[model samples]
Target: MQQQRWWRGATIYQIYPRSFLDVSGDGVGDLPGIEAKLDYVASLGVDAIWISPFFLSPMADFGYDIADYCAVDPLFGTLADFDRLLARAHSLGLKVMIDQVLSHSSSEHAWFKESRSSRDNPKADWYVWADAKPDGSPPNNWLSIFGGGAWQWEPRRGQYYLHNFLVQQPDLNFHNPAVQQATLDNVKFWLDRGVDGLRLDAINFCFHDRQLRDNPAKPPEKRTGRGFSPDNPYAFQYHHHNNTQPENHAFLERLRALMDQYPDVGALGEISAEDLLGTMTDYTRPGRLHMGYSFELLTEDGSPGFIRRTVEELQAHMTDGWPCWSVSNHDVPRVVSRWGQGSTHPHLASQYNALACSLRGSICLYQGEELGLPEADVPFEAIQDPYGIAFWPTFKGRDGCRTPMPWQPGNGAGFSAATPWLPVPDAHRALSVATQEADADSTLHRFRRFLAWRKRQPALTAGELRFLDAPEPLLVFERTHAKQRMLVAFNLSDQPQSVALPDLDSWHADTGHGLLSGHAEGQRLQLPARGVYYAVAPAA
Candidate 1:
């Protein structure tokens, strides 16, 4: 259980490679359909497998738009199927991590087709261009989050580039130091091909607004429930000059000095800031990013006073940094169908996924979130999400939590013998993975016994949370360390509830011994209906 900080309190299972598994029948997902589901994602005890981009793309913004940050996307396979998915995910001890997108590319990149073939190539200023103004409009008022003008033009470099999303991607101009050393040599060519880590994508859109200014308006109540939409005018402005730039913190210290030259190679970063937890506590403090994640609980809120004031403002601003907690991914909507509204309610998605692996960071689930797999109403002529076909029905994209991953209850739920690049929802074909691998109180076996008892809790893996003074829809806490403490509680309501641990004075009910045994409280604890409770703090 004390395995060299195996990514601290790790869980990470994300995978979205065009719907995770379609081994060459051409229905999409490949890499031998993720090397034939790397033993079903190493039987879901996940210590790693971040994936998400399969590179070589004109996918407009799919493989987050790279046209080859070193090959692979022949519709997702080859490089000997990503070296047999890195030799079967390092012989199933897991750890792989992938998606690097590096803030923008795919304007058919070959360095943006030689930085838009013009103004004296040597990669003509490598990308955020400009010019237009004094009459010809766009060189400023930036907007685009896939809807309007974040300045496009580029008539073979007459000027105007930027694109905060899909004007075929664009952005990348870390004010050039050979484009941040060829993007740290495409992350040292995937850590010289063994990978092991990097999620980076949109790491603060890699720099802009070198005073080619103009982002001011934003008002409809300071708009923020994260993913900007109020009829999407890119949430009416205030993106104060195209992105969070302070020269992208010296290009994230040259991408954390090329992920600190490799030993156990890590780098998470995806912080799409709008002050995202203050740019994820200044990009993971010590060495720019050994971790970073935000879209804060990927929204559709369930208020316990907004998840206790966003984990009390990320534990009063992450002191030792490290943050990563996603309640669902593949870009939102699937936290049990946006917080159990599409209800199948396996004990309220196992007490909100054991309150998202007893929060304190490093969590990531996604991939049909352990078979409680909601959100799949997909319609719009079988939409393949160009940001939900550009904001239709108010805003229904993200292909209903990026389809596919059903794994058998019949038909292509086994993820394919064919047909899958999206449509699967017959309510996730009886919640498959061969019907929750023969259901033993399945929510995918309570997420493999809540990630193997949170990998034997060193105070829920690297401790220090505090918050225990509960109330509305309850939300206690504890987590300690240097020889254990634990506690954690929640009910976030659905019906039966109660909480009075009397400051946990006589605690021992280790929640029925695994994800807090669906807590029942003979000494006072009945939580079912979005329930959850954890215990261990006794020694005063």
Candidate 2:
């Protein structure tokens, strides 16, 4: 497995601890709970698990805001509990990648507290502190991703500290070499502890423009990039000076050099910028991140052309760096709801999973993805996300996608002994693990079968991809590795479709994935609604 470079073309499943499983009867998921479900996770045939932030936090942004980098929060358990979780996951042959928020830390963090205490405190310059303009305004016009201006007034420091997201989460001064080294040291701590890898959160935001230049305004017609909502105001301008600075590459190299010391350890970064795919390319170059993914596929556009363009564009520039693609995560609405015309189509989810896994890069499958769970309907009364509360009706934020994972059909959906933090939707309960396990033809079983079957195909697992010309609702691609070449096709629509391959000497259809299989009749392949077809040339 060491020679295999396990992360390449790997399937990494993401688990949001707050909603995954609650073993402590506190209505929140914890490390021990993740450990308790290690076997279940392994059963899905994923190569690794990417656990969202479980570090010590005040829960302002629900674990994304870090108060202490080295300690685990009591809400999720202690450092010893993390050790146990790591041990059990490794014992099950699954790598564990934990989230590392390097761009910002909670205001409650001792470093930020000291930095904001006085102008010349020991750690005063540890954070991004800027004096107000002569007119007593923010140094520049920058908007927080959550809402409002990015600057938060610090009365003690007599300046405004930058917060790209929440006011409580202040950005660090990475331009200062001390801050850079300290952050890398924190990363070294986890690698030293034997975690398989790190999921660098907002890694590109580590460095801001040193000049503090004003961000150029983006025209209204050209105002769509990261999130779907226009009400958030973050999408109003081109985020040039705020993040994805040129100096950040050096820091990434430093981080990479640190990770290279650990055997087979890697970093998967989350990139969100004006040029999403282009920045993803830039961040994942040879000496930078091992792999990087963006919010491109997480959008509402689920058309065949859009998906093709995204992968094709990245593949065009993906020379030495690697790519990790995710169709669903805790940050956005569930793909089944977002992609399948505002509803959950079971067949569509199955086809989409196979399609995403079939792509050339590594794959990240969110927790409820296996069961084809759609976005849960979280009402305003139940909303906890601050971002959601800011822009309620127009944009519900990410609460729908962060509900508890249902393990059983009843009794708190087997998630907790008490009322869960987020209510487990009745629909999710019906598609719980226990319920799906009993059904022979469930989406969960299909998912397991596809992943298990995929591991045996080198062409599907680690191969070069080329998209073939096909009509709408049909995505056709070829994956070649060593001597094996595979032709993978998917019907993205609910209606059956057919595609003509036309130029093949001998292509044999493959099976065992348990989806709606397609047939290859003399270069003419017929696909059922949401069907998947796999074929290989004998000489290939």
Candidate 3:
């Protein structure tokens, strides 16, 4: 296989730059900090590291609101520091993938500043700008993910500029050829700098309805999968006019073409739409993105049936397209915290890490997931995420998942000498890296073991998945590659369960690094709580 195509079934670890580590004693993680920890990250056995945005930004939406796509944020070190981080990671045999927020930019960006100044400037049409309605209202009924209307009035231009997120993060006008070319040019700058992959943020929001059509209303039942709190009014509509436009495909094709010029470069898109599975399929077609992931598995549901059905649906739609699965990221609550229901369960984390990696597609493991860290309870006073601050009491913001990583047991958690950007929860301290490294049965060790073992199983890494008929609390599937076939089963609940299997005469159980041991007796398989079973059969 070619080196650039390594993401086919690879596991990529995600590092939230602000929370990973801090070496400058500035209370925030920087590129030098990430460089210093490259060895530890490589030890996790992940093939690549997909870092969140570290570009120059005004911090309105953190790094997602980029002020300069090609410049490194001062808070995160200089461009030279990033070069060192990349060099260090490559030396350790880990590919580096950085975030690229192309759909929008911080209002303070030079392009946006000039575009919003006057309608006749050279960069006037660089961003999504439209005339107000007869009554001086927004151009359309589209709503912002952070709350309120998606259109913000710019008195200087006498028009409204669109912003799917916060007012400070304005959407780019991809309808303009110049805007698309400029975005592609910005991407090439990074490609020349030697990044192995790009994780495109909010990729579907690149284009909008040219006619400025009003989006139809959405019922409460159909508003759950758009990657926002149900309490947010942004979920009340179908979002037809605001995002997931057809014209975005052309832009993606252009971006992919630019990437094709550089060997071993991959593009992963973050897509969230009304029909997320269908959209993921469309966005990752042959000439488009190499892979895409949505909020399907990131929701509140973690049941066996839901997981099985979600994968089955995506597999059905994505015949030639590749899908990426992530159980947790910087945007959502930690998987252990979300699925564990306010409790910490090392067993659940172990099962989740295995299941995510064993799926039929690539995997993205978030920071601290290996430690089985639950979501921190960031108080309102400590909240820094604008999305969370906007919907405070009803839905606490994402600050919980963005807290600093706990490396040790004492104050500062070995992350920094000063008070960190976010408080390190006491619960996380109990599961710190230092503590887990000493315990043989810790989730951290289990994670490392599973990844090492998984690398040796071709059927688990790059095989076709077929789900077997199993009841609740039991997820049974088969992965086959070439002539190698393996039967994989899991008991998702805390209660013991048993499933009838075919004749066991031709099968032998393979204990996979003691993740969870299950046994077979005759034609029945016995699985304890959160148990896993992997058996191999001779080629027919």
Q: Write the per-residue lDDT of candidate 1 for residues 230-274, one digit (tens) a residue.
A: 587887777756777877887787777766766777778887767
Per-prediction TM-score, please?
0.35, 0.98, 0.98
Which tens-of-lDDT digit does each residue in 1-540 have in candidate 3? 145588888899999999999988899988888998889899989999999999999898879999999999999999999999999999999999999999999998999989988989999989999898899988889999998889999999899999999999999999999999999999999999999999999999999999999999998777765347658988889988889999999889999889999989899999988778788989988889999975788988988899999999999998888889999999889888787664444588998888898899899999999998888999999999888888878788899999999999898899998899999989888889999999999999999989998888888888899999888889999999886788888988887999887775467888865688788988898998888988887645
Clashes of each: 7, 0, 2
Cα error, residue 206 of model 1, in Å, equals 0.6
Model 1, residue 136: distance off in Å is 41
Error of 3 at 47 (Å): 0.1
Give model 1's TM-score versus the native structure: 0.35
lDDT of 1: 0.78
Model 3 segments beyond 4 Å from truth? Answer: 1-3, 342-344
Off by over 4 Å in 2: 1-4, 342-345
